[model samples]
Target: NRALYRAKFDAVTARLSATLDTVTPPAGFYLWPKTPVSDTVFARGLLEKTNVAVLPGSYLGREVDGINPGANHVRLALVATLEETLEAADRIADFMAQCYSA
Candidate 1:
């Protein structure tokens, strides 16, 4: 059910130290995590290395007052099967940990 997806999403973010900034999505399968680095870079690296697709927060917002409020964030949609979602979470956690520790 919905709870399963939310729980998985929460677990992943909790492990990554990535802030889940958006108010619990009212009705969607997305988890928006504030990244430790540029979101675009993070997204690209994730896709290239882990084969996971994440939307850079920059693509979800517009620049205003010389700043794109969406900077340093990425959006993940836990819309796959439970097994796949967990696997993706694991890969993402490792990817982010590596990026941050480097």
Candidate 2:
């Protein structure tokens, strides 16, 4: 049932949060709004530069007004190793900084 599935998802997310040193969402219904576009480009540059892979938000039907809502956003896999993820995050940050500086 949906309730059971939700419970399992919450449990898994909790474990992932603990492992990743991230915060868990408050206990309640949660909606993961698609990542905004600004985040997408940063993520893509990171993956392309680092050889890591991620999905763009537009691929998830977040496109709007003929514009990709996630055009600036990238979808990272929580399943990747922590080190790989950290590297991706670092790359994204650097790329974004460079973009703004230019």
For model 1, residues 28-84, the per-residue Cα lDDT tens digits are: 777777877799998999999899999999999999998998888888888888778
Worst 10 residues of 1 by lDDT: 15-24
TM-scores for every candidate against the unseen true structure: 0.80, 0.45
Give the clashing residue pairs of candidate 2, or none: 37-72, 37-73, 39-72, 39-73, 40-72, 40-73, 40-74, 41-72
Instruction: Work out candidate 1's RMSD over C-alphas.
Output: 2.7
Q: What are the C-alpha RMSDs, in order, of all predicted structures?
A: 2.7, 7.9
On residues 1-102, what C-alpha lDDT tens digit does candidate 2 reach at each position? 445435543454444342222333444433232332455564466567766566765566555678865454444444444455455455544544554433
Give the Cα-based TM-score of candidate 2 against the true structure.
Answer: 0.45
lDDT of 1: 0.77
Q: Which stretches of candidate 2 lie above 4 Å from their native place?
A: 1-44, 62-71
TM-score of decoy 1: 0.80
